[model samples]
Target chain A: MKNIVKIEQLELASAVVELGKKVGAGLAAIGLTGAGAGVGIVFAAFILAVGMNPNLRGELFKLAMLGFALSEAVGLLALMMSFLILYS
Target chain B: MKSLFEQFEIDLYCIIITRFFDVSITTITVYLGLLMVIVIGMYKVSLYKATLIGNNNWQHIGEMIYEFVVDLILEQVGKPGILFFPFIMSLFLFVLTLNVMGLIPLSFTVTGQLLVTFTLAITIMIGITIWGFRIHGIKFLNIFVPSGIEPWLLPLLVFIEIMSYVLRPISLAVRLFANMLAGHLLIHIIGVAAIYLMQFYFIGILPWICVIAFMFLELGIAFLQAYVFVLLTLIYIANIINLH
Candidate 1:
């Protein structure tokens, strides 16, 4: 009986670890996916803004492009951090 | 009871596989998977008689990307750009595809990984270095020396230029890797924030708004980052080749 109880506890522990891993992965995916979608929306808006204002078009376009790059940097950083967290 | 979100903490750096040498195979597999899709898509378009007559979405998107890369090569690298076209186009397409793929739910953002970006940056640097030597031979060494400089400052200028040249891959890799890493993190934070703030109905709106705003911003970023990467590569190659 005691041996069976110990085996059950071991199985529970393994299950918990597996669950933890799944949760961690889920969180990372959610974060990156949202960011990717967010970036797309922002770019579309920038294009619309540029269409509206002819004078600010060139400068705004450049700034918008830079902003886009910066945002992508954030996504990459998050991805790296997620991996670090998962491994270490 | 605790919220569902409270039960989960994202591990951004989670390894899919944890073998030392095995990592290379995994990385290669990811790259090959990407290539397979691209190649298959191309094949389908070319093989289908319908692709010739009408504007299919996939074909249009592919062509648009091709034209954009060509424009980038022409504008930055100039007329001799043909030689570098394949590399630049591949780099741009690969990065662009990777970024867009990251947007898909549950898909891995291959570009978000340092290994991938560094590999690409190193490849570009090596290619340009080789091209420089091939075209200029021993004169390629002159790339370190600037014109219109005082004779006394020649050594200092050359030293600085060489250091800068050596730093190219580092900068290129960091720029791409950092951007992708940061963007994903911001989204994760916003997502967590939105969930946490939702306990208070009024406060919930602000987090949602922020999330919405950032989401749109990231979309533009996906394209711009790819463009900047290719643009810098072209500029670097142009410097090496002295095409201007």
Candidate 2:
């Protein structure tokens, strides 16, 4: 009975480790660098827009946000790569 | 780091596998897969041979998809472009399947990968170029020359046209890749936001509504992108063939 219990514990531990590795690899693949850069750029653009005119800031920020999403696409490639590495 | 834009990882399940075989081998695989599906389907059809084609659900749906592709090609590329029907139809269906597959929770969106989109774009570009040259002979070079241009401007116009021609595959690949990637990411963001919002308020009502709205929007986008990709391909081929 004790041996069976130990084996079950071992299996559960391995499973958890496998899941962690999968998640880590996936996270690594979606490169955070490009997204970080995109966010920074968008933030700067928003600040500049706001400085120009506070009233237009909201609309300009929304547009900037869209541009930011487009720019972040580069990071998505990395994300895919990580997933491939982890899962495949 | 706690910002709404915090980076998260996404792993795709599909990976491109390489073999020592040539591209004809891969094409053969696709052909065989298509044939196998048809053969198996034929067997299934035989079992229901007594039923008229339109009376069967699968047959009707299959014919509808076929007719839709045919109509799209005809509408976009004209009659002469019908020769390209098989290639365009296969590409459209394959990409559409892959794109939609990604929306299934935990399934990989193969089209979201640059390599897949780029390969498709390159293949279409190469195939169209070869077809153009084969049909037009050396006159295919005339594609770079604008008619009615003065002799003095011919050289400059050709240069610009050549650049544009070279950019075709890049633009084609980028358009599909951008659309797929952006749409998926947007959906992901909305989903993540909804999760976070659910934690804060009984505003469960609004979050669910937004989620459902976004789901439909993504579905529309998924189909739209596929249509746009295939449509542009037909247009590119039409341009190459100079079909009216």
Candidate 3:
């Protein structure tokens, strides 16, 4: 459905490489959508927990943080992969 | 000025020629060395005044941080973790300072570099593994086994546990690296957009507002990520100590 515009400076070989890199990077970025959902769930649960027990907010915040880091780690791994694909 | 991406490059300053080897000094070394100096100097100059209860402004701030970290360790790891107070506190301060310093205009972000974070994570992981073996002996391997698991499913669950355990260091390093890199890159793009839009002179406010909001978010994350790293380190150590 998508097209790569033919540029005068880009030869066939270079174009193929570029196309592959872009595709690979795009695929890697797809992982971010999942990360987005994961982060949303982390904060959502955090808020829900705080709402349930107002006094437990302090303890819950730390748990939320650990959860955030774990979920964000998954997403960041994907982002790093994309970065590596594009830059390297 | 270097291009946005080019700023991440590590330019060599000078090479040290010892009798046995040559060590290349670069921007990373400079920043890390500066970070070390700032962390050590800040704590020493502030806390060394009066050991019991110094009334210096920086001393009060340092004590507040010390109390916060102490509470965190006590809450998470309990009595055994008191011995690691200096290490954990220093780790938190070092990362917090590094992340905050990166927010300064035109300064290179040390944590944004994958190699630096990976080295930190790997060293911690290696140390924890060694410490686990030392304390728990063969019992440390019990960490991979769950108490309620079915006998037939033990192998499968253990494999999953071991795999996740091995991935911890990689995840820890990449999380910090990517977060720092993302914050910097987003700020750069927004900044450029804000500047360019100013030529038109009206809509520039939108990007500037976004830039300001993101800066605040970056500040919170600067603290959050450092705390997360230390907290996780403690939890891992706690697991080793309790073999749970």
Candidate 4:
């Protein structure tokens, strides 16, 4: 029984590595939530701007899209980091 | 279950012996060849029988793409940007085609590869940087400086400005690569799940339905990413030209 208990302890050490990988991956994915929030903030500002000045829709759209792309890029960077952690 | 990542594996077919080197053909080469033919053939077939005022749908699409690209350039870069029409149009079409090609079942998504997207991005970055230098001389470096800033803040802002400037190409590549990779991986996971679930008779139908919905979403993303890439490219070019 003591030997069996010793083997179980050995298994736990290796299992910790596996658990850490999964835990880190899960933490990395939390960045997607930040991304979601960033995208929401961007679009919310965009909609407010357009609502106030409909005529500026054309110009505002260019800026909005630029803002959207930049924000989305940051989100994707976080995602790629998590992806590298999980897959690599 | 078969590993879905098996779809991304590149298997070498054969190596061709050149005078100086060996060229090994792989899965990407085959798909890239097919993609080239498809894109070129599409333009040829569409415009081959185009009628000016007739209901030629394909021609209309071609023209619409042309007009849209032109409008995008004009809006962002003004008159000067129109010079980049060919380059921008080709960039949009290629990225769009690559994304759509991935949607076809069992095809390799070239855009999903970082090497491909990053090379294109780096090429654009270097080319524009050279272009900026050529047009404005060393003064083009003025781009790293904002107007009417405190001298103390200028040094800090310049460092930040230069850092962001250099990160442009990397951001451009990662946004596309990650978007394509994650999008395809999502679809593949759902598809495999659908297949496995369908083994349970009527219970399988729901996952298959979910698969179809995700397919549509993937298609929308493919187009949207392509447009976003082109839009961002236009903005970058405009910034370079106008230096504002």
Relative to the unseen true structure, what is the C-alpha lDDT of residue B16 in candidate 2, on a scale of 0 to 100?
A: 58
Question: What residue runs in model 2 are displaced by over 4 Å at the alpha carbon?
Answer: A1-88, B1-53
For the predicted complex of model 4, DockQ is 0.51
What tens digits encode model 2's per-residue C-alpha lDDT throughout A1-88?
6545677888999999888888888678557676788879888978987998999976685467545544554565566566555645
Model 1 alpha-carbon miss at residue B181, Å: 0.8
lDDT of 4 by residue, B48-103 (tens): 85744555887888888899999989888999998899999999999999999988
User: Lowest summed-lDDT stretch of 10 residues in model 2 chain A?
Assistant: A65-74
lDDT of each: 0.73, 0.70, 0.87, 0.86
Number of the top DockQ candidate: 3
**Steric overlap count per candidate:** 42, 5, 0, 0
TM-score head-to-head 3 vs 4, winner:
3
- What tens digits encode model 1's per-residue C-alpha lDDT throughout B51-105? 5766677667667777887876877778997787887877777787777767654
Error of 1 at A6 (Å): 37
TM-score of chain B of each: 0.82, 0.79, 0.92, 0.94
- Which tens-of-lDDT digit does each residue in A21-86 have in candidate 1? 767856775666766876797798898987888788876776667666656555655565566556
Candidate 1: which docking quality band? acceptable
Question: What TM-score do all the candidates reach, one by one?
Answer: 0.67, 0.62, 0.90, 0.89
Candidate 3 per-residue lDDT, tens place, B201-234, comes to 6564887888899999889888889988898888
Worst 10 residues of 4 chain B by lDDT: B46-55
Which pairs of residues have clashing backbones in candidate 3? none
| Candidate 3, CAPRI quality class derived from DockQ | medium
Descending-lDDT candidate ranking:
3, 4, 1, 2
Output the chain A TM-score of model 4. Answer: 0.80
